[model samples]
Target: MKRFIITEDGSHSLFSAQFNQQYHSLQGALNESEHIYINLGLRPALENGPVSVFEMGFGTGLNAFLAWKLADQLQKQVFYTSVEAYPVSMLEASQLNYEEATGEKGFMQLHHAPWGKETGISPFFYLRKEITTLQDFTPDRFFDVIFYDAFDPQAQPELWTEEIFTKIAAQTKPGGVLVTYSSKGIVKRALAAAGFAVERHKGPGRKAHILKAIKL
Candidate 1:
């Protein structure tokens, strides 16, 4: 597997091999995750009560970092779960500084906090990182918010299939929202087949659109 690659946007980072691209840039992947998913999809639901956030690809732990910081801000109890087949080494993990990027340092504790089947990182967030393949991530618990931030469908085609989404749908509570940076026809159809009310939303950078599917 290619350990690292640079994006066309000049963003450099490590590759998960599963997705075939670096998770995000040193400059703005943190910003985009916090702004798009955490602010838009997660914040509103948090205002009501405790928040449950599930991430498909926990690469570099950027999304999880942003989720923890936002949970602190919103004063919402947070349960964050992420699945990854390849967990980066501590050296590799240290290379990416999410705090400087997003102005959220609280996330750094998540890694140093420890790794296990289930653990609590802070008062607001209960984090669980499963070192297992995405296809093997059978959900024993449902989520209120699902962050479908996996690799691009082009690189990891199987992750975008209808059958995969059917499993994803099973984890989502009714009225739960699934958000991602992909808006392909097959992707949307698969989400629909899984019983989501799908919609196209504005994307972060050069990308024109993103997908937000509400489970019905």
Candidate 2:
């Protein structure tokens, strides 16, 4: 079962009984997404013209929404692809306070967008949400940015393996960036083994650091 919980930044995140984890940090969901994925990942990639992004998890659609908003603001095109094995239901998604917190609309529209095909969220942003696990997904094209937002190694160990990182690395373009809210030794080693130059950056809220790897 999944239930909504308010984070420190006044945004809503989901707690999944099956995973035994919250979708985002208890410190703040919106703050984390904006700082890690948007500021660190998407913004940098957008400088090189139209960007293609692949996300490992589409938990609350927060990252996607923020990316969409940024793309619109910059008037740059973004092709975002996200994969999720278990998607949040519309009812659960409706309970999120992201729209109110960010003062932006279209949170529901993002969730309501059909799965398995590309849909235009705005003139500058297009999204294709795949309903599958990272292990089962076959990438059709390379991406300029990757949001590796899978649950922690403790909760979902299989997704944090070297094999999974290698699979993702194969789909990332040279110089592409991959960002995640983890700085574990295993994660850094996996990224290095997958041909990435990994770096650790200061994290938001109570966390110490986050990982940002570049495809070599």
Candidate 3:
């Protein structure tokens, strides 16, 4: 079962009983997404022109919501495709306080968008939420940015393996980038082994370091 919990920053994050983990940082869900994903991941990728983004886990649609908010502000078009083996229920998503926190209503539409097909929430934002896992996902078009937002290796080690990163790297466009909230040595080495020139960046809140890897 999944339940919502308020973080230190007064934002909601999901606590997954199956994984025994909180989907986002305990400090603040919205803050972590904005800093790690929107700032470090999506913002820099926009410099490359219109971007296609692939997210590893669409746990609560927070990252997608933030991406849409930023993309709309910049008048940039974004095609976001996020993969999740187990998606959150409508009730669970509704319980989230993201809309109130971000002061944006697009967050609701993002959660309501149908899975397995593209849906446009705004003129600049298009989303396709895939009901699958990264291991089984095959992209028809390579993406400019990949948000590797899976649970920590401690909770789900298989998704953090080199073999999986290698498969994902194949779908990353040359010069494209992959960002994650993890700076584990193995994670960096796996990304490097898979063809990314990885770099470490300052993390949000309690996190010490995060990773940004450019596909080469």
Whole-model alpha-carbon lDDT for candidate 2 = 0.93
Query: Considering every candidate listed, which one attains the maximal lDDT?
Result: 2
Provide TM-scores for the models. Answer: 0.89, 0.98, 0.97
Query: Candidate 1 — which residues are off by over 4 angstroms?
Result: 1-12, 16-19, 25-27
- Tell me how far the alpha carbon of residue 113 in candidate 3 is from the true structure, in angstroms, after superposition: 0.9
lDDT of 2 by residue, 186-209 (tens): 999989998999999999888999
lDDT per residue for candidate 3 within 98-197, as digits (tens), equals 9898888857798889999999888889999999888888889899999999999989999988899898889999999899998998899999999999
Top model by TM-score, which number? Answer: 2
Q: Rate the local accuracy (lDDT) of all candidates.
A: 0.77, 0.93, 0.91
Evaluated at residue 42, the lDDT of candidate 2 is 95
lDDT of 3 at 65: 92
| Worst lDDT 10-window in candidate 2 | 1-10
Per-residue alpha-carbon lDDT of candidate 1 for residues 1-216, written as tens digits (9 for 90 to 100): 447644443434576664547676434575567656887678877977997888887777877877777778777788988888777777777766555655566655666656556677767888988888879877789898888877777888899988998898888999999988789998999999999999998777666778889999
The TM-score measured for candidate 3 stands at 0.97
After superposition, the stretches of candidate 2 with alpha carbons farther than 4 Å from their true spots are none
Worst 10 residues of 1 by lDDT: 4-13
The 10 consecutive residues of candidate 3 with the worst lDDT sum are: 103-112
